[model samples]
Target chain A: MTLRGKAAIVSYGETPVTRARKDKGEPRLSYWEYFAWATSLALKKAGMTTKDLDGQGLAVMHPEVDHSLFLGVEVAEMLGVTSKWIITPSHGGASGCVGLAQAALAVSSGIVDRVLCVIGDAPMTYGDTMMLTEHRRDFEKPFGVMGPTSLFALVMRRHMEQYGTKVEHTGKIAVTQREHAVLNPDAVFKERFTMEDYLNSRMIAEPIRLLDTVMRVNGGSAFIVTKTEEAKRWTDKPVYLLGYGECNNYHHGSKALSDATLMGIGQASREALSMAGLEPRDMNFFQPYDDFTIAVLMQIEAAGFCEVGKGGKFIEETDLSYRGSIPLNTGGGQISAGQPGLAGGNLNLVEGVRQLRGEGEGRQIQGAKAGMVTGIGAVQYGRNVGYNSVAVLGSEL
Target chain B: MSRFGVKEGGEARKPLPYITNYSQGFWEGTKAGELRIQKCNACSHKQWIPKAACEECGSIDLSWIKSGGKGKVYSYSIIRHVVMNSMAFEKEIPYALALIDLDDGVRVVGQVVECKPEDVKIGMEVEAFFEDIGGASIFKFRPRR
Candidate 1:
């Protein structure tokens, strides 16, 4: 009943990260087109055709988007692939790992052999700003608590008050990740900025400066999951899914605000690592979601990399670059590599698979056998994130 | 309406609330200059933004109770940039939006008035105040001196 060493990711693919087509003067591709581009690349990498996919998992860009454009069945029909099993995980940022876990279960349970998990979006053409204004409480919208920036700023402010965290503490993350981005050709931001630049950046929301936020880009990412035994037939290096756990701390029936400092990643990581029979120290690299730098800090603390409320010190003392003791976001993460709507959530997972598969050309961690990736989902009424999903990947079973 | 910003001329075009059946009581209470939240009669657990059933103990028997309108600031953010296209908040840049932990054990989000954004701090005592904007009573908070 466990996912440990049962299913393995054989291939990962993604379109080049870029500005929206409308912004870059290119013909805009519909969501389905982008999905196909990424899917085709993954299938090619796996040395398989459309006929090999018997299971599919997809995630819509946002809950407010039209169902016709984001449904799993619609995507299947558009791609001309019939699947025995289909699922549309709607966990927002956590959809990437959550979908992977679901697909692993399907593959392990003998329901399907290969499952293609893909997500893509055209935020620029589809009025992405409107999606931010939807699904909030009746009282929160009136006060301009609309987007993740403002909501995450609230969490950052609380962390500062409780733990004496400074702008410099969070700034270190941006600085370190940007250094990693310099080595990544696919990253949107190639040029590097110093800590002074980050500290001096204009404030988008108090405690969260302009540099602390993620820029929305246009792209898609995908991967194929199959049984570990069958994976050997496709590729020489197959990244195994060791363990995964997902949790929703605050929902309709729960309290509006939990401790903003300690997110649900704590429990999710505990379950994931326990299932894998591993600990934080066993991870060669960490790919905690970076929708905001504070999120990464919270995940680092919640995932047991460091003590709660000591994230500021952890960032200050640790070397997070590719060659550091604890490498992080070696592909620059969403902070430096532009966030491409829901697809941005998959960046960490894709990078983890590549590093484990020995495909990291320049930024590969030496002998990286195991890695961890985490995702944070929807913001709940500017109080806290609703979902947390964590997964552990290893080079071998 | 009580102005929180230094520069003032245009009417605030903040997005208004679309009241739902579960939230009508809360909005009605704001208009009447009272802070009302839901209290589970079975478990005595209080909650904000009225709900059909109690979040704690899953009891259907709930009652509306008027809160004391006084609490300490749990956390806050100063919005320096106005990203929303709404012109209503154009002049209200650099405002402090706070999460106030109500004395009734419920948290409410509102703008802090009568003080500069930098002056607001966590755990600062605050009291609720209402402003009638275009026939809608909007709730805000002011630092307690």
Candidate 2:
């Protein structure tokens, strides 16, 4: 079903994501506290309050966090309104975008309007207990694959073997994002980097240098979705979701080719673009997943931004240094913005909304209109190829 | 230990178990000095990295076909460094990581033991040898013996 002219994201909000947490002295707020503040900010930005929310949803990685009751109940109770729908779509990073699609469906179908989607967490303090790792208690969690980093490292090695891409080429992508992040004060990494810094960094996994991986940060981001007509009452700049698509493949198998390439994202992006009546070239900006530099390259290539095996070349030609030719990660992405796992994709979505609204701070893309956001979740160590969710956001409203 | 190049009269290697899965049978056969792979009867799918069912089809009907364990190297990498807490790989620096394409159209990834890293090459014929790693028996490749 094409959301062709039906619904749009009127406003998006995120709390300041800095190294030192944002909290008042007396008693520091918990992760949930930050989530509540961010959710309120998003609703307020859209010229509404929790009072306008008739539906609530959460996208998170931890199942034990009681995410449903935590965010859903709190938002509902704060608004003093009972919600008919409570959605908690948990699938790692992709959960945020997936939850957005689900919420959009609810809004479009008249199940309820004004759905608030939230994903936030404090990984630094509780991620070990909160995260699902190879050493964790899950049945297939062992197998020596620690987290997304190690798993992606394995895939990077395989891709290198097949495509003959040099490790230095992969470093270029990371270095470029670092350069972009340097310009974004809200970004965790504010220092400029040379390509040499990336290449000289310690190798975490073969072909995956320290600069290639994302740091775990404590943060949360949120969005407010309502019908287009209702959204127009709130904000003039409404980024409409033209299309939504998602797909997955077997994640746990050892087949190097299947594990390394993200065929799922490619399939989803194709369907999403087709539904939106747009093409890859029509996108003004792209917020490809940057959990790792290679991941970004893989997604870019898979989405037809460039031919397979040419992602590195695409990066070099784009002049991705600080003020790039093709501006990417204007919000510093997960690489430099501190990846809060499930909250990472929400960060991307929030930034996409900001860009479409022409309000990205420090590194806003000039006159940005059409934007694409893709989320990659559940690295290949699990039961299936990572799930991918792609959304096309445009400034048509 | 001599199979992987320790001094002629070197001390016995550490205890290890060959990872026994559905593939355990083939590993056991190799311990008895034979190389075997599973061949699916329904779809004629020859598979390495053994499984209970054919990946192409859900058929559990498979037969263990003895292989010469000889094949061409499909790809390779040489590790020149080690990270912290890797004592088990202490003396194996500059080791070769290779993928071997069996004549039966299946490929397996493992280190090529008993050969210098520089000597490894794509399309070079190699055979398998069982190596013990932290009490786990792993299949490693070597220049055809």
Candidate 3:
């Protein structure tokens, strides 16, 4: 289905990313605590209470412990609403986008007029390092390949070999992202970073410097999806979903990931532009996932927003600072901004919505009529998880 | 069995349960300090980071195949720092990370150790050496024998 002229993001909400090692006087703040905080904030921002929710969608990883908890059902009972739809989706790191995409379809299809999508946790629980080892095959885990940093380092090794891209080139991305973070009041890392700071940072994985990797965070984030008519009922400004696409290629740590040029985002971006009847030049901002600095380079290139391997050049030559040139990752991204897993993913979407609605407090992208948000999933620290999802969002229905 | 128990035949080696599923073969090879990969019997495709299924054809027919354990370095990085504590690395910053293309058509990324980080180069011949870290033999690439 074209899914054109259908659904819009009426309200976006999130608890500012925080590091809660332990839930304030609660049991370890399991996934449920984070989910509740995020969902409640989103509903409040939409000018609704949990009681106003008509439907719900649960997005998360860890099917073993997380899936059957019936979070959507739990929320419905809390609100005393007869939910018309309840969904639980597992898409690894891209779970938040998966939830939003599902919410758009639910609203557009009239399955639900409004839906809640959320995720978050304490980083120490399932940080990137543990996920790599815990989810890894026992055979491979023993080789001491215990983290994504080394796995990504593996991929960076090949890219630098093939493209002659220097570590300094990748360092520029960290330096610039930190600069943007300085302007973000809510960003976890507001410290100013010079290229020297990036260069001097310790190495976590070969090509992935300490600054290049995103730190774990404890927090929650959420989004509320509703129909265009319903969005008008709740708020005047509604960010519409224009286009989306997803692809998977799970090579693990074996081969050089195809489309390493970071052009995969373009695949979904193309579909979005086609759906919205728009073009790259028409976009006012871009929010490519910044789990790792190199991943951003790959995503922007994949989105065709810039040339192949020229992501470094684009960030270096142009002023991506607020109101300088085109604004990219104005939220400071997962790199400089805190990445609370699912919450971090929603942070990008929330920033896109905030900018589109002109509510961004200080780091607003000026004249932002339309925006694009993309997510990369399943990539171990260095290897491609071989999955990509992109969404094009706009101010009009 | 305990990971600390020493093996009878090998050089005071302990009984470490190799990683199962796709990586069991890889870990077993490292214990012997010899690198190997699973080759798809159906498609003749060479695999690294061993998997139970073939990546190209999705076939389950696979066999443990030994590698020449020698390859050309495709690319490399000089590590200037270490975030996690390390006893193996004596230096402060500079280290080499290289992508080595095995003769079997499989390439893997690993640290190029036992030499000055600056001495590493692309296209240089290198071989695999097993480094014992915390009772487990980890794979690291080095200059050719």
Candidate 4:
């Protein structure tokens, strides 16, 4: 069931990430408008046009907003492209990667020849995040659970309790990613921060600090995928889709109980690696979906890059910069790059493709081949770890 | 009732819990000062989030049972800031919110009362106690004697 070498990412497009731009009162482009704009950019880079795309895909985490519902059906009306196969995933942060997986399956199954997967949102400009947290009000919010920082603070505390992980460990990730952000032209937070700054930063929740959180920005990213043969003909340096795995509402036991410190990536990554015939050690780079610093640590351990409870030591010893071993979040993960609503997952996925194509330009990982990109969905809930998805990609089949 | 937020006339206004038809019995049990959860009749699985059908066995045969209200802290987070998200908990800054693994093999989250955030431990034994808040019986945990 592996989608190996079936679909390949030939081109990618990204909009500049920004917060409330005072000069422009509010964003002029709607969500689908951003999609059309980014899609045009992707098509231009690929030397292709909308007529070449028979498949269309997008990610919408919450349909709480009216425009979000039936978004897939509206793509043709918005982009004016005829879509024979359409996919719209509702996996929250995981939606982008999950949509990629579904598109790959549809393309491989001969349902569609060329699929363009685009993810974009303007929560900063158009929507209120408080409206999206409605489901939590009934069960989790009744307690003192304020938001994500508060919930992840619980995970960090448990990790510290169980593994003795320290703030200094998470500081390394924050500091390094900000350094990467400095080189990223599109990153919102381009200022370099230090361990001292991360440590002394204001605590949002007791254990989670301001530096551990990601700021929302208005942005979009799109990637064009076609048959592997066509992609190779376009460029010998095509980024092949090797494997994809997704697990939702994953918890242990018939009771659905889970260790708050662990994510479902253990099983998800295993399935991905098994399909790709690759191991955790074989991954040339890591571009994991990082809404919080604690999440990156959890994903690192759960994906078996390091043993459980040893994420602290592994990160301490590894150089995560682009030039170093196992380059992580080289394009500045969502933590430092400014998360662009549901497009955050594709940000990492697109980065993995970019690095494999040797297009990292400023902070390139030398000789990068195979890499892993991960996603986490709806993490603040008390027990259930929402959707966990992994996409394995490489320069070679 | 504990203060949620202050109104103009020296009165408090707080966001109250929404009791649904599926969870009406659970809230009723809380009102009666009992920690109640649904236990599946077919598979004997206990769940904190009550529903119409059993999650494991798919049996609609469910019954509400009172738990012993005893558990150990599985994890906890100290809330040093609350006004940023909810103005109702503005006065309750620096409170400890804990995930408890109850003796009845279920997990629940609640605020740890009668103790400082510094006093909370990972494996501390705690017992559930009810408090009237926003016209609802919400449970709070305290260090057991």
Best candidate according to DockQ: 4
DockQ of 2: 0.09
| Candidate with best lDDT | 1
| Per-residue lDDT of candidate 3, residues B30-94 (tens digit) | 78978887888998888766666887789999988888888887656665543332322433346
Listed in order, the DockQ scores are 0.52, 0.09, 0.27, 0.59
**What are the lDDT scores of the predictions, listed in order?**
0.81, 0.66, 0.67, 0.80
Model 3's CAPRI class is acceptable
**lDDT of model 2 at position A227:** 74
Name the 10 consecutive residues with the lowest summed lDDT in model 4 chain B: B1-10
When sorted by lDDT, best at the front, the candidate numbers are 1, 4, 3, 2
On residues A1-397, what C-alpha lDDT tens digit does candidate 1 reach at each position? 6789999999888998666665557766666777888888998998988877744443323322333633777778877777788888777888889888988998888888878988876665465333343335356666656367878999899999899888998899999899888888899998899999999999888899988888877788889888788998999999999988887864433374456666788888998999899999999999988999998888899899999999999999999988888899999999998888788889999999989988888898999999899988877653668889999999978
Query: Each candidate's chain B TM-score?
Result: 0.85, 0.75, 0.77, 0.89
Per-residue error at A99 for model 2, in Å? 2.1
- Candidate 3 C-alpha lDDT tens digits along A1-397: 8766577888766766656556554334555666677777777777888667644433333221323355556655655666777776556566666677887888777766777666655554543332233334333333334245655666676666666667777787777778778888889899898888888887766667889988767677777777777788888888888877766553333343232334345566777778878877787888877778777766766677677666666766776666766677887888888887656667777788889999877787778888788776665323454557778888875
Residue-wise lDDT of candidate 4 within A1-397, one digit each (tens)? 6787788988888887777576867554556666777778888888877767644443233321235566776776677676887777777788778877887887788877668888667766665552544447656676777777777888898899989999988999899888888988888888888899999999888788999989988777888777776786555678988887777777665354566776788888988888899998899999889989988888889888999899999999999889888888998899999998877878889889989998898988998989999988886355635889998999999
Candidate 4's TM-score: 0.94
Give the candidates in order of TM-score, highest first: 1, 4, 3, 2
Between the candidate structures 2 and 3, which one is better when assessed by lDDT?
A: 3
lDDT of model 2 at position A71: 56
lDDT of 1 by residue, B61-137 (tens): 98888999999998999988776344466577778988888887888888898999999999999999888755467
Model 4 Cα shift for residue A348 (angstroms): 0.8
